[model samples]
Target: MGIKNRLKIMSFLQYFIWGSWLVTLGSYMINTLGFTGIEVGMVYSTKGIAAVIMPSLIGIVADKWIPANRLYIILHLICAGALYYAASVSDPTIMFWVLLVNAMAFMPTIALSNTISYTCLEKNNFDTVTSFPPIRVFGTIGFILAMWAISLFRFELSNMQLYIAAGASLVLALYSLTMPLVPTAKKKKNQNWVSMLGLDAFVLFKKPQMALFFVFAMLLGAVLQITNTFGNPFLHDFASNPAYTDSFVVKYPSILLSVSQIAEVAFILAIPFFLKKFGIKKVMLISMLAWTLRFGLFAFGDPSPFGFVLLMLSMIVYGCAFDFFNISGSIYIEKEVSSDIRASAQGLFMTMVNGVGAYVGSIASGKVVDYFTVDGMKDWQTIWLLFAAYAMLLGILFFFTFRYKHEPEKLANVGVKH
Candidate 1:
């Protein structure tokens, strides 16, 4: 098989493992095992904690000791074992630790996969900028397929989802050995701990604009985690109402949620044009408002015919809410930061969003959900409205606080740098 084809397959399975379980696990924990909102949120927070701690440490290991492909293989092997064990865990605390192991093992592989792809692509004389996006799109396709597979097989509320993810992780572990090796970086003398840990990017905090941008990034990151950790469970809640039990929305919630992923793929393509036309400030403001609409629609949506339309609109707007900030934020960082700290700055961006933000969102949202529950019945409408208000407030604050003068002509150079 061609290298690009091979990379595409790698990308597919990498996300397939995640998609099989990520969206449905909350429902499984909540509906099947009768776990509390706080417990489930705690479980989800493991990913955020792992995201903060693991990626940089693993990156150092891959840079100094092991080949990237070899490390990728090892991490997936661990992920397989961790996920397999997770299937048998019933205690919320035990499950938290088990999933944390899986998260730690799994999160770093995302970056490692990209590193391996870039290295292999360059070695094969392909332009990464042109070639990698198409290959990466396969990952999103794989994610959607996995979600459909779990939902169709009726495994979304079962431990079988974990088994499926474990199976895929194992397969990827073995398959990774076939990929070309990626060399470790040459050891450099006198590398300080700050640089070694990628903490040097903290210098960006001295500048108010960057400091504010990062603050908003972290806040939006929280928004993303809130939806991810709760969206599936919220959809699954409709099953309790006999009036909606037979509806497609209740019967195939994951598949419906997959529409959000579909929108993501479509919206990603629209970003470069949007960034150039609207400028980053306006584009990001649009994203913030889109998030408000996303949650507001969910607050009003249901399995009824008209409500179903609202649900679909929420799924569609998720693309705008997610990509406009995430991809655009990365582009803004790349354009603004120095080349020397560019990679580190990117790492810091993810740390703020995925790491700290996810952790805070998970725990706090859990408390909010529990607060809205009485006699084990949740006030989902109120909960969603509260979240919508939060997003809207962020949009207002961001519009006033983050001041960036956008240069459309300069954005043309942003893509070229890659």
Candidate 2:
């Protein structure tokens, strides 16, 4: 297959694994397994926990011993097995470890997928900056398809959902064996084992601007997981109430939430325009500010169409809030870094937000939700309001603490240095 065809298949299967679970796992956790808030948090935070070490570890293996394609296959095969084990297991704590292993393999693949595609593109002298986004955006389409499947098929409540992810992963794992081999980077004779493995991205801390950006990346990452980890269960919590049981929000929550993906598709086009118009710093601040509204709007919105309107609008804003920072930040990293460490820098970036931030936020949010929603009362309003406040506080602090002067012409293309 051509690079384009390979990327198309990779994008489809790459997100298929995640789409099987991410949106509806909250509902499954709350309504099915009957796990406690902390346990649920820990389980959901598997992605975060794995984020800390998995990508970097895999980066080393890919660089030194194995080709990226081979490591990619290994990760997915491991993920498939672990996810299947999770489906068979009953204990939440055990499932934590199971899912943790799943995440350990799965999360790194996000970075690895990029590496594979970028490698192929670079070989053909294709521009990663422009070519990659349009191709990669299809991953979001896969994600949307997975969500719709989960809801339409009533897989959210099934233990078999994990199996669905595993099956897709199994397909991806096998498919990878047939894909073009991404050559492993040859190690330098004097390269420190750690540095060769991409640990050098850690030295980004030596620069104050770099340090500030990462810290804020972790903070913003906290907001990113809030909706994914809890919003479904929070909205579905109303189903437990007699009055809202028949509501559209409760009946078709995944479909309702899928609007965010639709919004994401539309907003991605606006990012270049926004970046040029407002610059990265302001665009991100706009995102954080929007997140503040996101949670707060949910806290007050009801099960009725009017309330559901607020929920829908929040989903719409989610595109702007999420895509702007993630893609723009990735581009910013590409712009600011040396060409050599750029891939590792991207990996570390994912590690911070999807990794460390995810772990902390999911567990913390769970504990808070458990505390407020005690005695059979699901105090989702209070829970959302707290998150809104957190977003607001982070936005305020980020505005004063991080300083970057954007040059519009510089923002237009990737790999262009000022």
Candidate 3:
């Protein structure tokens, strides 16, 4: 098979493992295992905890010792075991520890997969800028298909989802050995621990603009986890109401939520144009507004006819809310930082968004949900509205605080170096 097809299969299985369980796990924990909101939050927060340092730490090991593809295989193999163990646990605390181990092994693979893909593409003389996106989009399709499969097979509320993910992980682990070997970075003499560990990326925080950008990135990162942690559960909550008990939205919330991923593919195509025309600041601002709409629509939406429209719109706006900030932010970081520390800088960005942001959001949103609960029933509308208010506040503050002038020449020159 050609390298692109090989990479596409790799990408597809990469997210398929995650999509099999991520959105529906909360509902499963809530409905089947009877875990509390805080418990579920902590469960999801395990990903954040692992993201906090695992990626950079594991990255150092990959760069200095193991080849990327070898490390990728090892990590997935470990993830397969961890996930299998996670399936047998019912206690929240034990599950947290199990999932944390799973996250440590799994999160690093996300970056490693990119490294492997980029290296393979460059070796084959393909322009990564144009070629990689198409391959990456397959990952999203894989995620969508996994979600549909789990829902259709009624695995969403069972341990079977984890089994499916583990099977995929095991398969990927073995398949990864067939990938083109990515040589480890050569060790330089007299290299200190700081540089070897990629901690030099931390120096970017010395700049006021970069520091502030990361701070807000953390805040938005929090927003990202909130929906992921509870969106399906919120949809499933409607099943308790007689009016919505038989609604299609309740029966296949994952498929409905899959609409967000579909919208993401479309919006990702529009990013280059938006970045060139409006610059990163404005583009991110649009993402913030879209996030506001995303949550606001969910606030009033239900499984009813008119309300389902709102739900679908929320999923559509999620495309902008997610792709714009994440992709644009990465591009912006690439523009501002030196190429030498580019990989480390990207790691730091993931740390801020997925690590600190997700941790804070998961914990805090859990408390917020619990606070809004009365007589064991959650007030989801209020929860969503509060989230919307938070996004709106972030947007307003970002507008006045972030002050980068749009420079078309700089953006136009991007990717030319690569």
lDDT (Cα, tens digit) per residue for candidate 1, span 232-332: 87998998899998999987777898999888787776776787788889999999999999999999999998999999999999988988887678667
Candidate 2 vs candidate 3: the lDDT winner is 3
TM-score against truth, every candidate = 0.85, 0.90, 0.90
- List the candidate 2 regions with Cα displacement exceeding 4 Å: 26-38, 189-198, 408-418
List, residue by residue over 1-418, the lDDT tens digit for candidate 2: 6787789789888997899888777568778888786677768777888998887677656755678889889889998999888888768889889998998888888878877776777677675555666667778888999988888888887877889999999999998888888876655678886676567667888989889998888888878877777777777788887989998888887788889888887776666677778787898899888898889888888787788788888889888888877877776676677645555676788888898887677767767877996787878888889999999898899899888888877755554445
User: Between the candidate structures 1 and 2, which one is better when assessed by lDDT?
Assistant: 1
Best by lDDT: 3
- Which residue pairs overlap in candidate 2's backbone? none
Candidate 3 matches the true fold with a TM-score of: 0.90
lDDT of 3 at 200: 65
The sequence of per-residue lDDT tens digits that candidate 3 reaches over residues 1-418 is 9999999999999999999988778878888899997788778878999889877666566666777889899999999999998889899999989998999899888767766776787678775545666677778888989988998898878999999999999999999989998876665689888777657678888888899899999999999989887887789899989988889998888889899999888887787788889888999999999999999999999988899999999999998999888767866776676544545566678888888999899879888998999997999999999999999999999999987888877665554443
Give per-candidate clash totals.
0, 0, 0
Q: On TM-score, who's better, 1 or 2?
A: 2
